[model samples]
Target: MELTDTINQVVNLTKDEKLSIEKYFTVKTLPKGGLWIKEGQYCNHIAFIKKGICRIFYNDQDGNEISCFFMPENNFISSYTSFLTLTPTKENIEAVEDLEMLVINREDLEKLSKEVPKVQIWRRVIAENLFILLERRISMLQSKTAQERYENLIKENGDILLKVPLQYTASFLGVTPQHLSRLRKNSVK
Candidate 1:
């Protein structure tokens, strides 16, 4: 599984360490439209997406929900800024589809880190990955045209258009729904 493989690839966990760490994780599920974490709630658990999509969004000053990020299957997700600081998250995490995930609570993660120091390294790797993703998204928004952003999204995960709502995709691309429709239509032509 991706969870095991990613950890092993990052930290080179020993067989015993891998087996022992399994106790710290639990399988959890969320139906479509279910919220995993709400805005202003502490995100105590980090989840590895086994099968589904989760959208991370927050309301802007205009009180409009803005799609900030999406986590597809095989990736790890958490309100990283909130999880690491033990503060309320600004974004709400919701399942875009029925989700099956492996979740590890922060307290249990600390305990596992103590037992296996390699876990610390893995945590750092995960955090760095989150930063890289955020940075790339910011870069796209700051420099790329809407068309370029859409092209990048399509190149990266075209299936998202089929699975996720167009409105959300438009928000993610930093465009209005109508503009996204034009982009989509043009792509087909």
Candidate 2:
């Protein structure tokens, strides 16, 4: 995706502000299994996916990995709470496929927001959208049956089942791998 076009979708910027933004973003490549944000490390940057998929997850006491969400192409990925508070995050974001992303460090984003007034509004809008998405995920896990949740996932992202591994997708659906198998079987019937 074009960097300027993506940024413009978030906020309208003047010529100088556009140049200021262009200077701050860097393109980065991550191989499969690369950790964009490691558990217990500060997330210094937010990444916008240009290609491929990633999972945000945390390891439990028993070392079982639980996926919190998936970021596919054109989505943003970050340990947002850690990024905002400048603290280490328990969450780890790992590339599930070889990926290319546009990344901007928190400090650079902050500087841009300060220099460009519209950018600040853009940041707030991003945060609000993130919160809504998270809240809906929480609600689905709480209120929806596993079958419903799986169906909802398919409804929301039709190609996700093909793109993401079933194990990770099951975790996101709050179900065991075996349970996901049953769900998929039932769907076919």
Candidate 3:
């Protein structure tokens, strides 16, 4: 379903509340390899994916891009800390394929949150959920082996292996591409 149709699952929006959404959101498209948000720039908006996938990543000291996560259809993507605080982002979010998004800027979001009570409650819910997800991700990375991480990723979203590039998936697992290849082979047997 399009984000517009499914938003109620995240936060129930009434007819009036849905109308206010139009005031805050704009539809944008990014081509493959295009950056929606770049490192060192202030993240102004949170985007809801209407189509395709985006990779969120950061560069390591060695200049290797480390994948943080992949946002696919119906998901939201943002450099959350930067978006919330209006600070420069240390991460980049780029399209893995041609992407369509419905985006809401921080200023408009804040205004809508103030004017629309449901939106304000939804924003708080989003924050709490994001925080929990972040904490879980950190804990998983710190405690799990590369193979374990790869298996967990498969458990969560098996299609990611077929849809996303192996290199990016490897980075997200904190393993080299070769290791991922070996893991895939082992998992098949």
Candidate ordering by TM-score (highest first): 1, 3, 2
lDDT tens digits by residue: candidate 1, 13-116: 77898887888889999999999999999999999899999999999999888999888898888998999898999999999999999999988988989999
TM-score of 2: 0.94
Estimate TM-scores for all models.
0.95, 0.94, 0.95
Worst 10 residues of 2 by lDDT: 1-10
Between which residue pairs do clashes occur in model 2? Answer: none
Best by lDDT: 1
What lDDT does model 3 reach?
A: 0.87
* Best-to-worst ranking by lDDT: 1, 2, 3
Q: Which wins on TM-score, candidate 1 or candidate 2?
A: 1
Show how many residue pairs clash in every candidate, following the order shown.
0, 0, 0
Tens digit of lDDT per residue, candidate 2, span 45-157? 98889999989999999999999988888877889999999899999999999999989998888887787778787778879999999899999999999999988888888
Better of 1 and 2 by lDDT: 1
Which candidate, 1 or 3, has the higher lDDT?
A: 1
The window of 10 residues in a row where model 1 has the poorest summed lDDT is: 1-10
lDDT (0 to 1) per candidate: 0.90, 0.88, 0.87
Off by over 4 Å in 1: none
